[model samples]
Target: MDRRVLFATLILLAGGATGVGVALFAFVGVDDATTETTVVWESEPAAGDDGSGAAVATVDGDPLLLRPAVENGSRVVRATVAGGDETTWTVPISGPDAERGGGDANGSDGDPSGVSGLTTGTLGGDPVAALTTAPGELVVVDAADGTERFAVDIGGPGGLRPAIGDLTGDGTPEVAAVGTDGSVRVVDGEGDSVTEASLSGDIDRRPLVVEPDAEAGERGGIAVMTTTGDPATVHLLDETGEARWTTTPNVNPYSWNAADSRDGSVLVLGGTSGNIEAVETGDGSDRYEVGLQDLPVEVGDADPGTVYVGGSGSVWAVDLLDGEVVWKQQYGASTRINEPGVGDTDGDGELAPVVVNRAGEVLAMTQRGKVTARGGPDAVVYGGPLFADVTGDGGDEVIVVADDGTAIAADT
Candidate 1:
């Protein structure tokens, strides 16, 4: 997906809200509240080792805090509510392990409904915009002119921001937004209008957005995954808001997270079947699948090229041209990494580093945020070997949200 479209979709669906009813029933439909269960990973996630990373810096008045939601050999960090002169709530990450709360499809424990996961950061793009809070309350400004380009409100604290992309291949980017009520909204950038679809009841959490296929002279397509019961309902929606196909795959392995390469190849994370599968953008068919012992925390593709998969203190680089492992490295049997950012950090010829393995390898900002780099299996130099940027002034900066509501902009 284009970086711009990616960030826009994410911001629009930032908060978790109530659940709504939908007609698509692909997963195991759960009439009772979602059971909360603790997952015991055979292996634990390790914290990253620190190197001479970059410092934090700011562009306009708005500060940027670069905090990668490191993988969890340690514990899961729960976003906490920020108090005092703050508009947004900061999910707390201070516990020994990050907290995973089970709710209905919308991440709500069963109430009017609430926001699920809301974090501040950027995907892939120059001059990336950071989300202030969940979308229901916050509006995205141009930053340059502070012009209100978009205003978002989804009933309660709706923040299930959509993933931005050109699913229809229409140049005009669209956003896939989830409402506080389990309703999914596909907003067109050109029209600035929303087309919504809902199931019979609230679909647990927000729908996972994926561009399943792109046909020559054909409009692109999108996949929306919602909880049916134990299964996941994957709906294929075209740019015209028409449902073309639907699939109910048995994916009880892990919670679902997804990322796509530049060519539109899709990777589904956290499979219950203990594997990570890559699906072709052309068809929903599986390209390659890898066993995943640890929870699939985060997924990132390299500058529209390399496919970097990281988990349990290890990183693997996959070549998209052919579902082949470029290289896989173990930085340490013990360490933890967070939300990873991949791009061309150095002026080198190759694409940005797929995964940064070392702790200090990350480029740290003055504020102490990090930019990570790692070597691909087929790589020559220590791809990104390690570094960070603070200011984002021609360089990258780490945007870490402080314990308080204030966003910390560190130099990379």
Candidate 2:
């Protein structure tokens, strides 16, 4: 029998015993046998919802899955745990009486508010959810109870995300947001602007906060990329909101957010430019550029020396130092892959990079780019995947949200 057919048959058999259905059509021609997977839990879709991405947060010493969505004509953040405890916090994106759009809500003509980013961080030593809403707003809520901690205008039409770091070297994390006007605003726990700096050209991506390295003699800084034109410029700002150095890379506006190399010595950037460029963090100089196909939607650090680039239908693991492609996995045409999350999803004491496509197919690949496991929500997925030990089993669970707003956690 064909290997693919045999793998599917085995999955069906295993799933049958659990009253679950396993379909491996997405890996029909793949050579490796699929690993057994179980759906740990599934949350119902929110009413009048489009989609959401999952972020893990610690609430009262417990890990919770945070899903930010525009549901039922309101912008809200939903928190859930593996044991099924859930809380929904309605965010006042505009105002209570302001027109909201989404789901089946009446009296709304505006488009549904887009969740540009969802991240968890500390605000004055308390856990908080920083949610960026479309059209320009950053709403911070208490992670434990969904209470509105604070909200600040991010200044722009939207699409910019926030980064959390210590801008004052005070041991407390501050929020950094880039306005469309090219200004980076560092806000404190009280929602006050700690410092504001400007970059040339308009900015749309999240600002990267680089921490100081004492041993490397590297002073930490904030990095922002310009998205107004080709050959985009990258600016590195100091702790005092001053520009240190700026370099232009052969990149375009249609790029994902840049990521810092493991040692914080190089910044890796990828996008529609069809290449990954590594910029030296010390002086903002180009280190190396590796060509790639397909437009990259996200870039993430895989291991110490390798970074994974996720694009349409494929993911590439490239060596950071030499710009060499270590391994590349292709998922065929018409598949849109989100940024992959790395963890030991199989609890084998070895880390693997897991990716989810728009078709809702989840694939966990070995460090060498071989598919080690295959599972999914079996629904259309619009958000990137998040890894966390939601089951408190000390093993990470891959969580993804479907287009209908259902959040699914699967264990392999």
Candidate 3:
């Protein structure tokens, strides 16, 4: 997906609201609560390491998406937040002297040059934005003026945005990031010290912010991937960065996108083990498993009982309710898919699954995965297709990011 759209998807789960309901479904879905998420307090997921990867949660209320881009020679946060007045802010991507929650920013650590991830959430009762920059730096910005507040020196650079939440049930939000060394670091919005917790394996993707449900009361924890064994492990960290429970599911999870089921009981997640499966979110137990005709790249739910999965050259609809293959269609477009957009691209009032390929191709398909509209650019697409009414012409447009960092909106 365009780095910005990817950030939006990945960052929306920053506050530990819930697993990306869609991805947990396939890669990331918007239905965490409905699927019945489990906190995984003490058990280890069943084990089997075969795995690959997937998408993130895109914010729904943001007026415009902000992507970090280049301007002149420095890195800038490019924003389309305003309808017309597009804005750019030059980020201080140099140096590592800002204090972290527990340490001073030292420039001698990891690559901390360019900004890679951008996400915003409320911290200390104020609007706060965070970026994971190259050379190992976590810079917290005040969204009001883009002022640099916290610049901590981490050792490795990752594009995963920090997940923010009230991890301690202290009525304030805290930001959590997976350390390059397989550790979880959490810093309160107002503190200067971090609560670092180590996991069993290396941290694979960004940690997921799981929200509290009726079953639990203190607060939900962060769901992080620690791939040490073959099937890998999913560790549930409580508010204080303590491991509450760990489980190894049947498949090794690759993509961070996990969608919640409609009943809010399970998560649909991508398994590199050549299968798409559902697991109990709270305990990491396998609920169901299904084979895949192609490697899945994007996953979501069209409706209850129906899950939409986009792969390298095909899309499949799995009937989790009945454990049957609803429909699977192949469209030889490219190698992988960005997040799929489900909307009425045909202007027929019927929703179609729109997928953007790495080749800059957009395909609008029917509910049964039948192709409808196909259009895109000549260059490589850097992000997934975003379905929006950019022109306000009563028609939806497929917006994609080019490899050159340009947002290209194509009409369906």
Q: Which has the greatest lDDT?
A: 2
Give per-model CA RMSD.
15.9, 9.4, 13.1
TM-scores for every candidate against the unseen true structure: 0.55, 0.81, 0.67
Clashes of each: 112, 1, 73
Instruction: Please provide, for model 1 over 104-127, each residue's C-alpha lDDT reduced to its tens digit, 9 standing for 90 to 100.
Output: 232212211122232222222212
Residue-level lDDT of model 2, residues 1-412, one tens digit each, is 3434322211112113232212221223345466745778788675333354456787676777776555566656677774474554444445332222231111111124455456788888898877555566667778878778778777654445577776556687888777666767777888887777766687655677776667667777788887544567888888778888887775553444444455566777775645667788889887666656545445654566777777778777776766666666666465877666788776777777888877778877788776766767678765567776767787778877777667788886
How much lDDT does each candidate structure score? 0.36, 0.65, 0.52
Model 1's lDDT to the true fold? Answer: 0.36
Per-residue C-alpha lDDT of model 3 across residues 186-301, encoded as one tens digit per residue: 77775465567776666646676665555443346777777676677777777667777777765556444444444443555565544566765566666666656434445544
Question: Which one wins by lDDT: 1 or 3?
Answer: 3
Task: Rank candidates, lDDT, best first.
Answer: 2, 3, 1
TM-score of model 2 relative to the true fold?
0.81
Q: How high is the lDDT of residue 403 in model 3? A: 52
On TM-score, who's better, 2 or 3? 2
Count of backbone collisions in candidate 2: 1
Error of 2 at 395 (Å): 0.6
Ranked by TM-score, top first? 2, 3, 1
